[model samples]
Target: MLATMSTFELIDEASDLGQAVIKSNVYQHYLLAKKELQADPDAQERIRKFNQLKDQYDEVQRFGRYHPDYDKVSTDIRKIKREVDLTETVSVFKKAERDLEALLNEVSEIIARAVSESIKVPTGNPFFDNMSCSGGCSSGGGCGCS
Candidate 1:
């Protein structure tokens, strides 16, 4: 017979898992990269400028407003982003950031799948086509995840 775990036991286990994640190589690299990025003033300014430009572009698109300068600004932003990505410090930080995110997502999916199976809940369709995944869908229109 399998031994049942108490609520406290489960909580303790979760805490242990969290501590392990904090000690993982992915998490350590993320922290180091973040610190390096924060210490670099030039990189900080570039990121700020890029974010501001992206916000402006998004705002215009959100309102369905057309501006002649939109294309030019978009092109300039892309060029700036490319340059930023080419920088060693920022590039390393970005890769570390992505790695941390993927690790978190993998952990979340594992927990979700376990709970779903235990409760007899219907998980997502296994065979659904993912060709349209833009990795940015929100409201589930043609944005994918349809």
Candidate 2:
């Protein structure tokens, strides 16, 4: 069975990548600050600062990837892929297909509203409204979110 993704699914996936990039960059800055802190003459104070930075970095890492809710959704999607007979459940599939379509429409509308309100959608350059993928890398692995 072939799985299809909607444009909004792509958008959400892209947004996930965008958030990951931000988190990774912050973590890198954190590591750098940590190293700088380590060399300070006040050893105990520096040690405390290092642990605090480390905890914040670790918390962001956990928030970005190791969440229980994400694990559950991943598991559910996998299970559905393996067990559901797409041909046998046309109505169910069709209903879900419509739901996804509706969801995508809603997402687009939200973005339009944000744009109209002069709110910047933080995902990256807005050029994806017309173009295609260009594989690139960031020193901080920001996924370029473009």
Candidate 3:
């Protein structure tokens, strides 16, 4: 019963943390930017056009045929890609995605470091903590050589 209660408490705390993340300004902006990206028809069309051109090029490569218009298609694809990249909605959405990704990465790293620290195994010198010996040491055991 005690173990179960503790588990529930931990879950509740995690849920609260998740709620806090969702309420953060960064997360809110990410949601808004994602909505803007979804609602922009011009941005969607540009992305679709780029995909179609890419698929056509892939098909040509798959059939091993020398496509006369390959260069033209590639150029068009690049142009559409550039235009889509320059679109405000797309750019905002990408920035928001990167921001959210960075936040998540930081959270993950913090969690990982905390967990690792708690369960850390001693590796002799903390400063030169390499798991394996490089075997390049002039004196066998001095430089992490077992």
- Estimate the lDDT of model 1: 0.72
| Model 3 agreement with the true structure over 1-146: per-residue lDDT tens digits | 45788898989988987898799888999999999999999999998888888888786666453677767776777898899999999999988877776666556546656677443333333344334423443465765654
Query: How would the candidate models be sorted by lDDT, starting from the highest?
Result: 3, 1, 2
lDDT per residue (tens digit) for residues 1-146 in model 2: 55567876977877985566446644445445445444544544534555555555555557756664555555554444443333233334344444444444445546556568444333333343222222342424344534
lDDT against the true structure, each candidate: 0.72, 0.47, 0.74
Structural RMSD, model 2: 23.7
How close is every model to the real structure, measured as TM-score? 0.65, 0.23, 0.71
| Best of the candidates, lDDT | 3
RMSD of each: 7.2, 23.7, 9.4
Q: Clashing residue pairs in candidate 1, if any? A: none
Give me candidate 2's TM-score against the actual structure: 0.23
Show the colliding residue pairs in model 3. Answer: none
- Evaluation by TM-score, superior candidate among 1 and 3: 3
